[model samples]
Structures are given as structure tokens and as C-alpha cells.
Target: MSAHPEAARASSSTPQGKPRKAAFAAWIGSVLEYYDFFIYGSAAALIFPKVFFSPDDPATATLISLATFGVAYAARPVGALFLGHFGDRLGRRKIMVWTLVLMGVSTFLIGCLPTYAQVGTLAPVLLVLMRVLQGLSAAGEQASANAMTLEHAPENRRGYYTSFTLNGTQAGQILATLAFIPVAALPDEQLYSWGWRIPFLLSVVAAVAGYLIRRNLDETPVFQQASADQDVARMPLVELVRNHWADVLRVVAAALIATASTIFSVWALTYATSDAVGLSKSGMLWASGCANAVALLAIPLWARLSDRIGRKPVFLTGALGCAVMIYVYLWAISTGSYPLVFATGLLFFGVVYSAANGIWPSFYGEMFPARVRLSGMAVGTQIGFAFAGFAVTFAARIAGPDGDNWKGVATFTAVFCVICAIAVATGRETHKVPTAELGLRPAKEPAKPQISESVSS
Candidate 1:
């Protein structure tokens, strides 16, 4: 089918967008949103097992705590459906503000919850509820930010502009890790009693900063033009399903690449610190922090390369590279070598995996037209991210009784990376496609008329 004519016309007539401003808003907003989201992850790995769950069975508590981390992923798709609709209909700015506030409030509340020692079953129950709220807020956060940035970006640099969102995410992860490093170093009594709560409470600062930036930010020209022309989809989810189902499916499959992240950030942290490996929590946290620090620099460079070449090659490179690197990283952790752990962690996540991480914002956003862009990206990516969220729980199960079966966990994560690579391999290349023409199928050429043999004779 052809591109939306109204959208194409609007693109031509609209004034130049504030691409840098939009990218900055996306970057800072994501930094805050994911900061709230990832602190839960850090706590789930290092603290929640002891505080929220029963101490009777350390094994079961660890398993359940990791499962709670996935609980947010389970809630994300539902949040995406609701938030994506409003983002497409009401405007990306509104949804962005709403998500930030919701995430901040929920995260802060998580810090206040009483632990199992204080409230028994109610403690974990409340934690799960808060995690679900975080999931809902995150559901719309990235998709809306990506759509806003992509529409605002210059035609030739969508990849570069949209990459800032993921860059912000890496920064947030770094921030979360850094926050936890000191907390993780506390004496066990102090650490479990009050230290972990500090990171969750700190989310308030991020919320305020994010709100200040996003409130003053201007809406994207493409969205404004669509609204002006009455080209906004009344039911973006329905429109996305009817016209863009294949792309949605492709996104869902490709997003499994996040499994690598879950394994790295959550499961690997748990494994390294477990009795079998006996690595220090602070040391592992430092390794992750350093890896994310490298990613902060690597993500933008890889994104610029995608803008110059195309999204597919860079994305595929990362996905395929991750499939191989997962083994090496897991091996490093199993060997009890901190230096090897840091080196492989940096190579796997910071450098190789970042190619896919940096490019997906643009690559996924460009798969649908402006009318359904928010909904399509939100729903597709969230569904896939759900699996990535639960992957830590699954990885724990597969890693044998000792939870030190690095090979088994590596094999499981590698399988998903391969699946993600295959999914992206089937997608349309959109880096070179004009911003207006994005998500539209190309026009087919007419067949030439055949000459009759009799007439020729």
C-alpha cells in the first residue's frame, strides 16, 4: 500500500522540527523513567530475595524475587495497549508526562513498603503491585519517546537522533548500578534494613528533572501536522493490527534480543554472587557499571553508523555477536575471574550488543506510519520485552540445581539472540527510506506487454 497521502503532504508543508531538542527531551526523560524501572531490577537481584521473600528457603526466595522482576514485563503489554492508544490519540507529550509521574510515584512507594519481617505475605504482594505500576509506566515511555524523536529528526539522521533514547537508558542503568554499589557494600544488616531503599527513594529527583524538561518541550512537527490534517488514527491499535500486523510480529520477535540484557544484568549478577561462584556484590556491580559506562560512548557511535549505512546490518551484527559472546561472558563469570568478567561484559554488552540496542529505536519506529507509529512500536516491543523480562526467571530454572550451569544459561540466551537476528533479517530496511515514506510499501512496477510470435513472424 502507498504512504498516507495526508501525512506526506503535511511532512512537506510543516516547518523544520526541533530534532535536537526532541532528542534531548527523549534522552533525559528515558534517563529518569528507566532509572526508576532498573532500580527495581537491581534490588530484585541483590536485595529483594532477602527482604521481600521468605528466608526459609534461600533458593526459592531468589527464584521468586527474580520472577517479580518479570512481573513488570507481564504488565507492560497491557500498559502498552492502553498507553499507546492515548499516545496516538491524545498526543505523545501527554503520555510521556503521565508515564514519568506514574513511574516515579510507584518507585518511591516501593521504597516505603514493609518487608517480610515486618508484614509477612503482604510485603511481597505490595512489591509486586508496585512493580506492575512501573511496568505500566514503562510500557509507553520508550515508544512515545522514540516516535517523538523519529518524527522530529531530519530525514537523513533518524537513526542518530532516535538513538539518544537508548543512550539515556544505558545512562540510567549506570546510575542505578552506581547507586547500588555503595548500598551493596553496606554490612548485611544495614544493607537489607535501610540501604536498598535509598535508591528507590532517589527516583523523586529524576521525576522532577524529567518533568521540567518534558513539560517545556515542544511537540513534534509530524504529530502536529497529523493532528492538523485530522490524520490521527481514531483507534491506533486496530489500525496497527489491520495494516501493520506483520511489522508488529517482526518487532515482537526481534525484541527477544533483550534476553541478553536480562541475563547479563539480573541473572548473571545473581550467579556471580551466589555461593558457588562467591564473587563480591560490589565487584560485580562495578563490572556492570563500567560496562554501561562504555556503552554510553559506544551506543551513539554505532547509531551514527546505522544512519550512514542502514539499520539491518548493525542490528544483525549485534544480535549475532551477542549469540556468541554470551558463552564467553558466562564462562568468565564461572571461572571466578573478575578481570575476565569485566572484559567480556564490556565486549558483549557495551560494544557488540549495543549495535542492536542503539539502532532499534529508529528501526522499530520507522515500521509504521505516523498514525499508528506509537501504538505499533509500543505493543510490539512490549510483548517481546515481556519475554526478556521473564528470561531471568527462566534462566535461573535452566541453570541446573546449583545455578552455576553457565553453559546451559548461555545456550538458552544464545537461542533467543539467534531468534532476534532472524526476525530482524526479515524486516524492511528503513534507514534510507524517507521519513514520510516510512511504513509504506513501495509501489509495484507494471508488467511489460508480451510480443506475439505470430505478429513478429
Candidate 2:
């Protein structure tokens, strides 16, 4: 296979890179995109059961609502394949703008949906359809944004620049949680009726803002050069599979680390505020908000550290640390100790998980040549994330009757974290490799002839 000429040019053209502007664009776009995506999670856990599903069986309704949250994940891989192909074929900037628009439109429509009481079975069906659209939009958002930032980043600081995408994500999560605090506090009648729609309706503003920002952004020079050189893969997915399948599988496994996020943000929220724990919904939201606020500071720092050291160590630290901390965080919630919950939540998610979250964009994007980078990252990560998306429903089922099975949920999450660590362990250390040489097989050294002293004489 031919080497990526754009990578060679990118390695030398540091001054031409738009690291700051591109990073900011990626950051703001993710903030809006994930804000739209996460609001559904908050509603699913807190409001959707009563509004969208049959109220006759509260337990069944809760499980079904959570399942609706996962419905987006099912659609993500499909979107990844379609959007990723065009992203590689057309350009990343176009896909970024499209995803923002789709997410905003779907989210706004979700706010306008009629409740189960109003429309009977059609309510959940509409909810699921909207969630699927959100999932599809999300499928391309991170991968395209990550590719844009990374290709525009200076070779030595790719981790730090790409980190902005996730920083935006953490910020979005904070916004989503905070948005729900006031709404969640409304009286049940008002909450079920109209208060819940406010957050979803607010997505239009974010979407419009994100669209404007993304549209003004220039395409990454790396991608532009590839296009000029006619180096863009005609079938990026086919090329990706032929040359980078193992890396794809590795990314799929490494991406499972996201299971921890869903469990913490969604399932744990439900568990903490359940009748069993008796924790206030506002308190849990505040705790989540605080942790994500801390993560905003921590993500770039961890990404910068990965730039200095390597993606593996920082990533492994996060994966392993999260494996242990899941137990501690969940245990804190189960004990009904608000202090411990806050402390451990900050430690587990804000500080520790940010290491993995901040670095994966750079780490995974580096695994493929520029030709296939977007497709590989999108397809592989989305497939793995599909499982992560459903993790809430699985956590609900594993928690058993009364939903006090915090340990079971913790164990399930921990196992995936460990798997993430192990998968990353087997992958190449791409940090030290030059941008031009990434995804190219290293040249084999010529064999030296063994000569004895007698033979030499």
C-alpha cells in the first residue's frame, strides 16, 4: 500500500495547522451535540417512564424507558457506516454540520411529542424514533470532530488538541445535568406535562450555534491535501477493513470503556434517586454536574500528559483506575452517603475516567492512515459504543428486584473497563511514531549474518 502523502506534508507544515481554531470548533460542536444527546438520558431516567410508557407496571415501564435510551445506540453503527463513508469521501466539516442539524431537529421534535396518556402506544414509538435519530447524529459527531482537530493539530500535540472534543462533551454533560435540575424540581403534574420539554426545546439554540460554527470552519489541511492528491480512498470502509481490521477490533474493545460513563451518568442516577436509596434527584444531578465540571479541567491535562508520555500509560491508568473506582463510587451511592458519593464521584469520573476519555480521540484516530482515519474511528468506536449505549438497560436488569443490586452493576461495568485496558495493551504505541508513518507497517530490519571467529579468520 502507498504511504499517505498528506501525512508527510502535515508533519512538516506545522505552521499551516489550525490547531486553536479547529480545536475550538470541534469543542463547541461537541458541546451542542452531546447536550442534545444527554438530555434524553436525564429524561429517560427521571421523567420518561411515566410520560412515554404504560404506567400499569412501574418496574416494566422503567425498564422499557431505559431501553429506549439504548435505542439510539442501535442506530449509531448504521449511521457510522453511512456518515463515515461520506466523511472520508466528501469531508469531515460537512458531516459535522449535518450531524449538528439532525441532532437539533430530532431533539426539538422530541420535546413536542405527545405523552403515553395522550397518544397511547404511539408515544414510546415516537420517542424511540427520535432517539434513533439522535443516535445517528451522534454516530458521526465525535469521529468527524476528532478527525478535524487531529489532522489540524501539530504532530507533537495531537492528544492535547483532540482532547477538546471530549472537553466539550464533559461540558455538555454538565449543561445537560444542570438543565435538568430546575426542570426536575418542578411539581410532578407540571414536570410530566411541560417542564420536561424545555431542555429538549432548548436544543434548537445549541444546534443553530453549532451549525454556524461548523459551517464557517475550514476543512482540515490534511484532508484537503489528500483530496488534491487524489489520495482519498474510494471505498474507505473496504480499505479500512482490508488493512486495519485488527486495529478496528482493538478500538471496538477499547471503546467499551464508555460503558462506565452510561452506568455512572444514567443507571447510577436512577439507582441513587430510587425509593431504596431515597437520595434527592436534585442532589444527584448536582453531584453529576460537579464531577463533569471537574472533568473539564482534568481532560486536557490528562491529554497533555499523554502527549508527553504515551497514550497507553495514561489510558491504562484510567481504565484500571475506573475498574476499581466503579465499585467505590457505586458503594458510596448504595450506602446512601451523600458525602461519599460526591467525593467518589469526583474521583472516579472527573479525574480518573477523563484520562481515557480525553486520550481515545487521539489514540484511535492515530491508528489508521489519513485515508481511512475517519471511517475506521467512526465504524469501530460506534460498534463498541452501541454496547455502551445499551449498558444502562443491562445495568437495570442486572440490578434485580428493588434495584439495589449496586454491586452487580458495578461488577458488570468493571469487567468492561478491564477489557478496555487489555485491548489497548495489545495495540501499538502510536505517540512516538511520526504523523507521516502512522498506520504504515514498520520496515523490517535486514538480518545480520552470524559469523564465528574462525569464519572471520
Candidate 3:
């Protein structure tokens, strides 16, 4: 397809720092947003059961706590519907700034809320409410960030540039895990009483930094031209449903790849610490930290490779690799082999899974036009991620009668990874498609050379 002349010109005129600035802003913003998100997941697995619910049955309390973690995901699609509209209509920077503030406020409030001892049933209720708000904030964070980075990036390097968003996500998970390491070590009394609150409150630092970084950046020229051309949709959801339902379904299926992450991070943590396996909480957290740290290096490297190759090959390798490796990693943890656990975790989550993680922003964002890009990505991914959020509960259920069936959980994870690979295989290749021509139904052909006046005379 022929590229848009204006967009090509805009690309040529791009300032040296624009792409880097966009990538940096996205990375920092994502780190802050996900820090707030992952810390809640950590607490759900490690602390919330005892502090937010009754102590009647440990298993039931744990279930309820993990369910609360899933509640945020319930609100995400709804949040995406609204936040994505504003992002597509108003501007990416506006949505980015607002989401960070909302996330910070919600996380800080979580730090201040009273415990089950003090508030009875109200504690869990308020926790759910705050989680919903966090969900709302998170709904738009990554989609907008991905759109911002992808649109600003050079055509051939979109994979590498857009990857900074996931890199930020990994950094957030690493920071959240590191933040919990010391707290997880404390005596139960001190840990539950105050140590748990420390991480939640520290989100303010990330909030401030993300806000200042995003506040000054200009909107993407693609979006600016869309506005000038009056190409912006009045209701992006309606447009998305009418024109691009297939692509939306593709994103949702592709996004299920997240089950691997939730399994690795939340389900695996809890399972490893259960009596059946018996690893220390600190050891699991450290293993998670090491995997994420390696992902920091591996994600960008894979992303750069995707720039050279197509996005599908790299993504499929990761998806299918994750399907096989989940078993290996879980079996290692089941055997209480810490060294093997660390090594496999790094390979599975860090290297193999990272191919999908790093490529998805550019891969998925390219599926829709600028008019509905933010809304399409937000809604599709949030829905898919909703399943991912509940993957913890589902894996727990899949663990069977004894609740230690690593095989059952691994099978469940592998099934979904296969689904993601299938979805990606069905989509059009966008790595070589110009940013301007992306998402157009019948791609326009290049102009033919004109005959000279002298030759005609």
C-alpha cells in the first residue's frame, strides 16, 4: 500500500529526541502505573488474606483475596470504554496524566484503609472499591502509552521503540517484587501492621515523576493530522464494533498470552509457598525479581529482533515456548530446586515469554487506524486481560482435588498460549506496513510515473 505523503513528511521532519522522549515518557509512566497494579497482586497473594478478611478458613480467605485482585479487571473494560474515548478524542497526553493521578490516589488510599479487625466486612468492601478505581486507571494506561510510542516511532523501528512500554511494565513488576522482599521477611506482626502499607504509599513518588515527564510532551503528529482532517470518530466504540470486530477478537485472543504472566507471578508464588511445595516467600519473590530483571534486558533485544524479522515469528516463538516452559518451571518449583527454579523462571518468563511481551504493543496497535486506535487496543486487551486477571483463580481451580496439580495448571496455561499463537498467526503482517497505511481495508497502490511534456511533444 502507498503511504500517506503527509505522514511520510512528518516522519522525515521528526525531531531527533521526539521518539526517545515518547519512549522514555511511556516507560516511566508504565512503571508507575504497573507498580501500583502489581503491588496489589503481591499483597493479594501474600498479605491481604489475613489482613482484609476473616481468619475463619485460610483457604477461603485466600480465595476471596485473590478474587478481590480480579475485581479490578472487571472494571477495566468499562474503564476502557470511557477513558479510551477521551484518549482518542481529547488527546493521549491528557489521558496519560489523568490515569497516573487516579492510580496514585487509589493506591495511596489502599495504604490508609482500616483492616478487617478494625472495620469488619467494610474492609473488604472498601478494598474492592479501591481496586475498581485502580482498574479504571489501568484501563487506559498501557493502550495510550503504546499508541503514543508507536505513532511517534520511525516506521522500521516500531517494534523496538514500542517495546519500551512493556519494559516499563517489567520494571514495575521488579520494583513491586523488590519492595516486598524486605516486608516478606519481617515478623508477621510488623509485616502485617505497617510493612504492607509502605509499598502502596510509595506510589506517590512514581506518580509525581510520571506526571512531570508526560505533562510537557506534544501529541503525535498522526493524531494531530487526523484531527485536522476531521477524521476523528464521534464514538470510537461504535466505529470499532461496526468496522473492526475481527481485529478486536484477534487482540482479545492474543492478549490471553497474559495467563502465563499471572500464573508465573501470582499462582506460582502462592503454589510454591503452599505446604505441598514449601518454598519460602522470600525465595519465590527473589526468583520473580531475577526473572523480571533478566526480562529487562531480554525484552528490548527480542523487540529489536522483531524489527529485523516480522512480529509474528518472534511472538509465536514466545507463545509456544511459554506453553512448554511453564511445565518445566513449575515442575522445578514443585521439586524445591531453587537453582533450577530461578534458571527456568528466567528462561520462561524472562526470555521466551518476553518475545510476545515486547512485540505486542506495536503488533496490536498497528491493527487499527488512528481514529480508534486507543479505544480498540484498550477494550480488546482489557477484556483479554480480564481473563488473565482471573487466571489465578482459574489455575487454582484447575489444580484439581489436591490443589497441587502443577500439571493441571501447566496444561491450562499451555492451552491459552496456543490460543494466542493461533490468533497472531491469523492476523495481517504489519511490521513492513507503513504507519500511515496501517488498518486501511483496501491498501492504496503507489502512483505511476508521469510522461514528460518534451517526450509527448
lDDT rank, highest first?
2, 1, 3
Tens digit of per-residue lDDT, candidate 1, span 120-151: 99999999999999999999999999999999
Stretches of candidate 3 off by over 4 Å are: 1-17, 443-457
Tens digits of lDDT, candidate 3, 141-200: 999999999988988999999999999999999999999999999999999999899999
The alpha-carbon RMSD values of the candidates against the true structure, listed in the order shown, are 2.4, 2.9, 4.1
Angstrom error of the Cα, residue 340, model 1: value is: 0.4
Q: Candidate 2 local accuracy as lDDT?
A: 0.93
Considering every candidate listed, which one attains the maximal TM-score? 1
All candidates' lDDT scores? 0.92, 0.93, 0.91
**TM-score of every candidate:** 0.96, 0.95, 0.94
Error of 3 at 428 (Å): 0.7
Give lDDT: candidate 3, residue 425: 98
